[model samples]
Target: MDVAASPTSGPATPAGPDSAWMLREAEQFIELFYGEGNGQGGPAARMAEIRAEVAGTGTYTHTVDELAFGARVAWRNSNRCIGRLYWRSLWVRDRRDISDAAGIGTESVKHLVEAGGGGRIRPTITVFAPDRPDAPGPHIHNEQLIRYAGYPQPDGTVLGDPRNVGVTELALRRGWRGAGTRFDVLPLVIETARDGIELFELPPEAVLEVELSHPRYPWFAGLGLRWHAVPVISAMNLEIGGIRYPAAPFNGWYMGTEIGARNLGDTDRYDLLPVVAAKMALDTSSNATLWRDRALVELNVAVLHSFDRAGVKITDHHTESNRFITHLEREEEAGRTCPTDWSWIVPPVSGSATLVFHRYYDDADLRPNYLRRECPVEGGPDRT
Candidate 1:
């Protein structure tokens, strides 16, 4: 974070819950999204009211407009995000009232159906219950509403995403068994220490998964690899207006490498590089062989090709990188400093191939953003 430019410059970090920081963040967000006054004597008046309330014993309630604008700017301020080009278009569903497990479960299913938009996946977020001064909020224990089960065997190999092995084990312990496939939707575990836990098995109809297949290789489909249509990250907490929504799940469209390079290709996760390399008959005897790289390219090709064939909305790394530059230029024109993580802006695959790899950015962590919190589920840890 640039200290000289921040309203809360005295603090080295910006993660603390300070009323002044919250108000300043809110003012900047509202002014950028909805110009001053909006017929209400501008953000200045709104900030005055918020300031008095924060200083006093009472809590301030952000207007619906304020809430909507906060959600949008949260995306814009996400330093690790590359899809900020469409940050202004995020469809924010205010579900802060539904606190129960069953209700949130139903709403989550609806979220998938609506966000997926039948494969025309829309960038969306569903803000669930928020934390209060007296109490905590409802939370989603899974990283995403739709993710696969990880079954670890004694042979030291994982059948699915090893990163989710703990969650899968918990799900199985809770009687939510899987079919042992590479793509199985882990039950949506929603809970709070006060409200208790409830396991929700997402209806197969609600989850739209596309089968992976290369355009040139028909055998790819037989490998039985698939991915969900929508990636609704339900685990992270959304902090805005000095209030934290512990279960505000947000999502953007996926870049092919998220699946091909990290999820599927990472050695600790699916670890399919060796399998893919063997499938293409590439030599893996040494690092000089470049077998991993060669195999990953085709795997990414399969991912892109499959998503395109299935009519699912998936962005390629190159296109998304260009879009990030466009977002940066727009933010600059609006007199906004675009806080970004250089490593994240670069694509997982072909880092040097994107224009974003050639630039440095202000690395300030901003407000109304998401955070990964640690809270234990009723039966397990909230690893997600």
Candidate 2:
């Protein structure tokens, strides 16, 4: 999994921001909103109100419209994502009033259900309460809302997704237990200033997983591989106009290569290429055989075929690459600089074949973007 690493420390209690900086960020965002023809009133009036609010309370609140617009723009400002073509269609759930651990957990499950859309996945985000001047917002300890648990065996091998071993150990420490299966979904560990830390199990129905099988290889089903449908990122902080929402879990549908070329095929993760190669009876005696490449292509083919047969919304890297090009053209026509990270924009598999691989991109760090949540400890999470 190339997703952001899960938070391994205690609750994220970010310090308060300066009132002057908050006002400046608010002004910039307000101008962008009105300039883009999405604001209710003139930016001048909004700026005046925000200034007064900030002067009185050291922070200001965004209207529902501002929040929604900010979130969509944040997605647009995401340099690494290849699916920015439909940024305006993102469904924003304003749950800013609920800040408790229980409420956040329940809403997080609801987010999965609604965003999954019963296999027809929808791009969605559930915005939780933002960190206030006096209080920090809630934080989800998992990198994603749904992840497979990893159990370390005495023989020095992991039973499940190795990317999740840290959070899995943390969950065990909190008296949480899984069914001891390779694909068992880990519990959501949410932390709040008021409620402390609490564990919430995601209901079975909320998680929609697709059993993987190849289009032509009947033996592929015997391998017993499966993956969850939606990737709901939870650990990142959504910074909008200097207001940081640490618990906002957002999702976009998967690209087949994200699962096949990275999660399952990567050596540090599942490392299933050799298993797949052996099953195909490929010549693995020498590097000249190109066994790993052949197996990787087949595995990616299976991922796309399974998702399509199951009616789960997924895109192939080629199609997504073309769409990204379209998104770039549209952004250019609209006079907006579409900041992009070339390394991330290129597909993990067959990079040279994708259109994104040929282009250079501006890797500027944009504001109102998803920022990685900093680890509270000194050196960060132990990867051992």
Per-residue C-alpha lDDT of model 2 across residues 1-384, encoded as one tens digit per residue? 122211122222236678877877788899888999986769999899999998898788989999999988888887778888888888999999999999998999899999999998998889999888788889988878888888899998889888888888888988998999889899998999998888999999889999999989999999999999988888788888878898888888888888998879988778899999999999999989999999999999999999999999999989989999999999989988898878777888898998999988765566677776664311122111
Write candidate 1's Cα lDDT for 1-384 as tens digits.
Answer: 000001111122244456666666656655654562243567677778777876773346667777777777777777777778887788989987888888889988998899888888887778877665456679888877887888888998878777778778778887888888777778988886577877999998789998899998777888889887677777666766566777777766678888888778888778889988888888899999999899999999999999999999887889988988998999999887898878667877889988999988887867766665553532221211
RMSD per model, one decimal: 4.9, 3.6
Best candidate, lDDT: 2
Query: Residue 348 in model 1: shift from native, Å?
Result: 1.4
lDDT of 1: 0.74
